[model samples]
Target: MPVTVHFAAGPAAWREYHDHLPRALADAGVQAEILLTAPDPAAVDYIVFAPSGEIQDFSPYVNCKAVLNLWAGVERIIGNTTLTQPLARMVDPAMTESMVEWVVGHTLRHHLGMDLHILNQDGVWRNEITPPIARERPVAVLGLGALGRAAGEALAALNFPVMGWSRTPKNISGIDCHSGDAGLAAVLSRAEIVILLVPLTAGTENLMNAERLARLPKGAVILNPGRGPLIDDAALLAALDRGHLGHATLDVFRNEPLPKGHPFWTHPRVTVTPHIAASTRPLTASAVVAENIRRGEAGEPLLYLVDRARGY
Candidate 1:
């Protein structure tokens, strides 16, 4: 008998995945039935989910083997007591590639002072400023997860001395990895460009507060492609206002669409992007989902399993 895979990631997601998923499952040699609505929740063997999905109560799906998340960040549904199944977060290759491109693009923008040229298109010739090369700039990436590690290594490839910090120690080939409080301070103190990619958790909320923000070298730039709550907005604005920091290119926020009246929208030194750093492509994401479901049936360990204690 074929296993039942319930698609609970809402209407738009259904439209995106409906065509790709079945082909991916077939390519993976998995016999499965994908259902948009499961009349008998107990019959569901697996669930494809997203935080924006309609299904809030996982209790009814008693027989479901796993809850496969469609996004990398699982903060929205991680704390739900009703969800008891093994949860796995999406780690798509395409998404990783896109994130690396965004990070590299922005890092280069700041390093070369591209904005100075782009924004000043007036006929006046202002070629006096000569920006330093990549080798002279020091960069720090605050998270060593897949996305963070990829971005850090890419920067290091460009000869921009890259330092990476995580909650625990890591040893990536090209990255100078550090951990703990002293490690964080060490990274922040020397870095000319700081990138925030750490997950949002109880301990990480407002990780970059006033005291920590003050530690950054004067004229340092920050690029946040991670969670918004990772930095305290008030502290960031104050730092920019006093010209203690150079600039901030933020892709995520504490509140998305960022309220029209928010100061960040109008701040001269702040660049607000509409959370477009990375996105899960249905074609590639479906393959990841299919492979995991295949592994589940074969009694093998699933990829990117979220540890409940760590809340990733």
Candidate 2:
């Protein structure tokens, strides 16, 4: 019997994933019927979901074995009371590569102070300002998941002393891993560049409050490609205003499109990117969705299953 899979990720995504998903399912050896719209929700064996999609309440899909998310971050949909199906977040290789490139590019930009030369081409040689090598710069990555791990590893390969922190302890070869309150404080103190890649949860809201921001070494830079609420906007503004922090390159924000009059846009020390750090590629992400459906049919453990208790 062919498994029934519904594409609930919306029209735009349906257009993108229509062919790719079917091909991926065939490659994964799954006998499945993909539907852009499931007239009978109870017949749906699997649902490919995204927060931006049409379906909000999942109660109608009674037989759905799993809800496969097309994006890594699930905070928006995780709290939905109607969703009882097993959820799996996308962990596409293309997305990871994009994230690593963004992190490394921005890290290098700040480390080498390239903006000074790029923006100010006033023929000022500025030979006196010599930036330190990668080895001499200490960097901290505040997440150890796929994106964080990949970014941290890339930085370490370039000889940047990369210290990583998570809610719990993690052991990676090149990263100096830390956990708990004391560990976080330890990493923040010495890191010249602090990268935030942590997920946003109740406990992590405003994680970078004024007190914690004050702990960072003077003139330290912040690169946040992670969740927006992980940082306190007021505290960050204060830090930059006092010159306690050097610069902040932010990709995500509390309100997206960032708001026209937002202080971050006008702030000289802040660079606001429209959350382009990483995007779920249809080709790679569809393969992941198909593999999970195959695993479900084969009675195997699903990949990248969301831990409901942890709220990731």
Candidate 3:
């Protein structure tokens, strides 16, 4: 009998994410059953879950293979007491590529002052505007994990003098990596563009506070594709107000809707996007999920597994 798989993130997921994923799963010879609501845990073989979904009682699934997460960040579900089963987080290559493209494009856009050239209809040749070289412009990526590392590598490849700071020190092949207080300072001191890509862990909460914000180079650009809580909104706004930051391009936020009345919408230097930087395209995501399931059945280490102790 084919292994049963169920997606318990509801019907909207069928349209938004799972539409193309089933085909990828079929290629891997995995029979996935996508349940709109939580099913009998006994009959469930594999579960493709979202943190925002309705599956609360994981203790019932005695024969479950793995709880494969649909979203990358699993902070909301990591603390569930009944979920003792091994959890694997999503890490799709398509998603990674998309994120790299977005971050790189935006960095270049700001670095080159592309907007100014587009707005100039005067037809007068502005020859005095020579953009700064990437090597001299320091960029600090706050998280050194998978997505952050890839973004940092892309920036470093462009010779932007990339510095990656994570919760722990990570030694990358070609990047200047740093961690903790000293590392943070070193990176921020030289960084003309600062990107926040860390998760919303307790230790990382309000990571970009007033003191940290002040440490950055004056008139630095800010790009946040990570959790909203990683930055203190008040501190960021104040920095921008004081001309410490040139611009802020933010994708994710503390609230999903980002209320119509929020100051970010009207802030001249703030560019708000509805979290489109690192979306998990399920065609690639399903392949990752299926591979992990195959590894689970084969008694091998699952790929992209979340470490509960570290709260990642």
lDDT tens string, model 2, 1-312?
999999889999888988899999999999998888889999999999999998898999999999999989989888999999999998999999999999999999999999988998898787778999999999999989999999999999999999999999999999999999999999999999999998888888899999999999999999999999999999999999999999999999999889999999999999999999999999999999999999999999999999988988
Over the stretch 1-312, how does candidate 3's per-residue lDDT look in tens digits?
666777876567667765666776677666666555545768877888897776888998888888999888988999899998889888889888988998998999889977678768688888788989998788989998889999999999999889899888789977889998899988898899998988778888899999999998888999998888888999999999999999999998999879899999999889999999988886788789778877776788988888999988
Model 2 global lDDT (CA atoms, 0 to 1): 0.95
Per-model lDDT: 0.96, 0.95, 0.85
Order by TM-score, highest first: 1, 2, 3
TM-score of 1: 0.99
Q: Which structure is stronger by TM-score: 1 or 3?
A: 1
- After superposition, the stretches of candidate 2 with alpha carbons farther than 4 Å from their true spots are none
TM-score of each: 0.99, 0.98, 0.94
TM-score of candidate 3 against the unseen true structure: 0.94
Output candidate 1 Cα RMSD: 0.7
Q: Quote model 2's TM-score.
A: 0.98
lDDT value, candidate 3, whole model: 0.85
Tens-digit lDDT track of model 1 for 1-312: 899999999999999999999999999999999999999999999999999998999999999999999999999999999999999999999999999999999999999999998999998788899999998999999999999999999999999999999999999998999999999999999999999999888889999999999999999999999999999999999999999999999999999889999999999999999999999999999999999999999999999999889879
